[model samples]
Target chain A: MTERISFRSAQKKALDIARTRLLVGGALLAAAFLVIGVRLVDVTLFSENGPSRQANARNIAVEKKMDRADIVDRNGILLATGLKTASLYGDPSIIIDPKVAARALVGVLPELSEADVLQKLSSKGEFVWLKRHITPRQKYEVNRLGIPGFEFDEEERRVYPLGRLAVHAIGFTGDDNKGLAGIENSFNTALSERSERVTLSIDVRVQQILRRELAAQIKKFKALGGSGVILDVHTGEVLSLVSLPDFDPHTIKQASRSEKLKEEFKNQQFNRTTLGVYELGSVFKIFNHAIALETGVANMASNYDARKPIRSHGFTISDFHAENRWLTVPEIFMHSSNIGSAKMALDIGVAAQRKFLTDLGLMRRSSIELSEQQQAIFPAPWTELSAMTIAYGHGIAVTPLHAAAAVAAVINGGILYPTTLIRRDELPANGKRVISAQTSADMRKLLRLVVENGTGRNAEAPGYLVGGKTGTAEKPTAGGYKRKALISSFIGAFPMNAPRYVVMAQLDEPKGIKESYGYATGGWTAAPVVSQVISQAAPLLGIAPVDETAPNARRASAIKVATPRARGQGIATN
Target chain B: MKRPATLIIFGLAVFAGAMLFGVAFEVSNLEDRLTGLNKEITRDRDAIHVLRAEWSYLNQPERLDGLSQRHLELRPLEGRQFSDIAALPMRPNRVPTPTTDPVSAETAPAIAALVNAEPGGLPSAETPIATALTAKPKLKPAAPRRPARNVRLASQRISPEATTSTAASDKAALDAALRAIFGNTASNREGASR
Candidate 1:
């Protein structure tokens, strides 16, 4: 009985030890599980910078960035955009038959030479680029060839959808996607760094209209080239700027590199609207008239003796169609009298004229968003002869853009706003008042008179109430002026009661056409172009035609020129 | 009791581990799906970029102008074709009687032909109405024509000629004829048709 009791005690002691060890193991396991659960929750729910979130953030950063931003017109029409394309590359090592692969690629991409591609595919290097910027269709065609060694590297290409339409404005990019000219060059950093589109103030519709009309005129007149600009007068926004003989951006690199096309390529790349400064003849009279009235040196009734040519400093200033009689202020402008304008300029003097021209932004390079702008060539000496010739648009060379912007200021209630190719949500608040409202009003009347009964009659777009001045400059040679090679141009504003837009059309060396009565003058060549542009563009611009026959309309635009008293009949009658 | 508790705690630990493993597997599957979706989105975005460029190229003004010249009879809008709503004479309550009316016979058949010619009915209906209202005609159309044509005539109300009586009578007859055809729904049709 004693031996049995001792055996039971030993068994009990072993059970107690095993039970205690089991409880300890369970508690340790629970603690480990709790720690793991807490760690999981902390990593997932509580952690501020989780691995998954970090990966997502990195992916978002990659997705948001682009090589270049798109360029769009004011109407959000795509002008220039970046297209991600695939470039075909060959693995020379893996290519089974280089000849067959190259032949296949040549068939798909005809522009690629078979021999060159064969050489590349058969080369020692492991990789070779066959073509860059392959279209999706081309990539698909290449894939269908079942070439084992061919692959594509993703790349971004700058594409101008409108081709050559706005090339000078939108510019072109190089193979490295770097801008080389025009707006692309000017806003390179902005375009490269930002993903947002750049919206320019160009209207593609109006640009087409201007381009079509200008090209038609250029073809008809047998002119060397042409440039045209249409600017919103009130806001100083360029609606359309066109320089003809513009080249397609795609061919620019090839054209530039070609030895035979070097001169032609440079000529085509020239942005004439802002860069070519010419002695834009009678168009300067618009400024001359405005300056005369603003400085209180002349008025609508003021007269200048235009009977004889004014000879100064071995130069004789005479009108093309000379009115050999003493003329009234309005008569001189109506006839585009050079002698009268020269005399008026002498009266206004040099300092006032320079300051006025500077204020009108004509003396300096235009502040337009272009790198092609040239400073106006004004005489540094400020001689009497210079003032006289500059008055009639001689001795001073300014770009067509300068003349357009100045005219915009003259008609847009005398406020000179810096011309811009960028759209603004509001009218710029920084416009400087250059003339009184009354003087601007009177200038509008005088301008209308020119279109109504004077030299710019061809510029009239019946009910649009077009008003303008015509300029015809003889291209100056090394020795003297080349009378036959004329730069014919017209600067005009429409809806003259409240001018909304300023249109300038210029033709380089336009020959006389049969329809223009064989007169290769501004009124004959460029004025009709402006008339057609206004008639077509006015409707597109949402400008309504007024009843020009209304007494109020007729009377408002009318400027009475005092009759010349029958050539000194006042004394004769007395 | 201690033995059962120990087994239960070990069982709970295994259950939690199994659940954690299943959730981790599911989370990895979800992450893979997210990556796939992101790749698909990127591919779609690239395609859209290409399509947008092509769309812009096809809609170039010069190309559209050429296409329109070839395929459509419409010309660019002219300045004379626009006028203010205020410039339009007041709408006459009555339709004018057929007097000096050669245009309705011509315009009615022409309009009906246009309506039949067009696949979409409403645009054709509005185009003729706009042309008739804006184009000032010296001769008035018959009573069967729309009343808006009469409004164009009534704008000549300022004229001092004695022909006002005939015009006034014609307007009244036309209004009655229109009311007879459209009934009270004439107003509703007029508004809805435009």
Candidate 2:
């Protein structure tokens, strides 16, 4: 009986142990399944709402790829672009036979010398450059040579497709594809980011026309050089800006090594349109007349005595083409009379003249997209003689760009807009009003009178109603003005009934030609260029030509001159 | 019943896991294909960019001007050649006035008659267009009258049955008309060579 009782207790203890083991194992398995199920749900459902870490990493890799943006003209014509090219390189250490490799390379690239290639291939370096920016045909030929050590590196090179055309404006880049000049330098950051393409306000067609015409005149007159700027008066967009002796941007790297060629290249790179400042001659008369009319210091009927050369503080002021008599305001501007202009400036006073120039954006560095710009040279003390000479465009020197902009302000209904190379969606709202509308109209009429019967008669386009001023200033020397060297320039606006554009052409140190009747004056040299440009570019710009014989056009352009008391006075000579 | 139910749940879970894995594999394959296509697109874009730059370089205005002067007969348009729609002569009232020489016989006589009828000139009466056309008497006498006869003769000689004699004359007339339209081809070629 005792043994039976012991066996029963043992069995009960064993059964208890088994139940505890099973219960523990079952709980562990259930906990493991719960953890995995929660994890799977989290991964499949919540994870879809956000990007995985790997995807984020791939996106970063994509963003790191760098490319430069393209530059195009206003008409969507490609001006400058980056092209992919393969550069040839070699692993000299891997080359089996340096002489054979060099021979093969020289065969493919005739420009590369055999000695240079052999030296490079035999160098004790791991790698060396055979050539940079090899053409695809050459690259293929080199690859087909079955040379094991040779390799190609994919690279980008900036190319200006228009060659020498507008080279100064659409600048070139260095070997590393970094912009070193022009629009390239100014907008370097935007280009490297490859965010969007850059579109300039330049019309390639207009640029071609302006360059061809200006180059022809520069050759005809035998001038040292020339520069031209065409500005939209309403918007201040530089339609065409040209400087002569421009170099081709594409092959600038391979140019001849002669010192003279290098110096010529440097000179060609100097942008005269915005960088060079000159006394701009009588183009300032347009500003003077506008200021006189705007300030109410002179009117259509107001008269000044130009009967004799005015001597102010030992400085003699006269006109190149003098109408030596008491001259009305219209006659003063029409004849570009220096004595009349000085007397008128004296009436307007020095402070007012300075203020007028300052307001016209001539006293400061004009704002443009180009990094190459110089401030205007003006008299520091604002003396009486300074005011007198400045009246007829001396004592104050400005860039062709500045002169063009100021002329635009005078004829573009008196608002002064900052010049720009980039196209604008809307006209800038910050333009300051410099003159009254009525004064602008009266000034237009006087300008038209000058083009019609005065010194600017050569500037008239037969049916375009062209109105302008001619300026011929002797270049200043150390002691006095040079009698032979002259800067002849013409500033003109077309369809004077309502002005839309301002064109300025300047010739530097033009010599007299036989056809010019031995006179290298603006009327003979620069005025005809303006007429040709307007005649050709008008139809291109969609400006219709007006009928000059029509009664309305005749009446509209007629100038009323009030005769003065000193009409029969003696002639003034410089 | 409890054991069978547990076994059935396990089987369903295995089936679901297999489906999930299959879908994931398919998605990964498509993603790979998309990546390859993207790379191809990038390469094509780069190629197109290069081609466009080359095209622009080849089509530069200076180069095109030289090439056209060599191969084509064309001249730069002049401002005087442009006229307003109002300046165009009114189409004759009657369409049946067809004549052998359309340009010279019909139009020139009508223009001359109009100029004569009104002492002040055409009905537009002192339009600049009339003044410009009249001012260039040298151009009017030669340009308007000669091209008309040449064009008529060239068109009438298009028949295939023409003998060699007539064919030669036809060819000469056609050549003259082409020269007049384009410019002096011989002179252009010479200028290009120089």
Model number with the top DockQ: 1
Cα error, candidate 1, residue B156 (Å): 13
* TM-score of decoy 1: 0.81
Candidate 2 DockQ category? incorrect
Q: Pick the candidate with the highest lDDT.
A: 1
* Interface DockQ of each model: 0.26, 0.18
Instruction: Give the worst 10-residue stretch by lDDT in candidate 1 chain B.
Output: B85-94
Q: Runs in model 2 with CA error above 4 Å?
A: A1-66, A90-107, A113-129, A145-149, A312-314, A562-574, B1-32, B67-194
**lDDT (Cα, 0-100) at B168 in candidate 2:** 40
Q: What lDDT is reached at residue A457 by model 2?
A: 93
A65-122, model 1: which lDDT tens digit per residue?
6789999999998999888889989999999999998888899899999999999988
Tell me the tens digit of each residue's lDDT in model 2 across B37-122: 66776777777877899899998878887898999987664455543323323222222244542433246434644443332454
Global local distance difference test of model 1: 0.82
Writing each residue's lDDT as its tens digit, candidate 2 over A1-574 gives: 7898899999999999999999999989999999999988898787885557766665454343436788888888899988888999999999999999899889889999999999999999888988999999998999899999999998888889998888878888888888888888888888887546889988887788788888999999899888888999899899889988788887777556688888888888889889988887778888888888888998888888877798767877877787677788888888888898989888889999999999999988877888889999998898988988999898888999999998888887889999998987788897889887887788778778889988999998876888889998888889889989998999898878788888888899888989988999988888998988888888889886655655446754677775575546643452
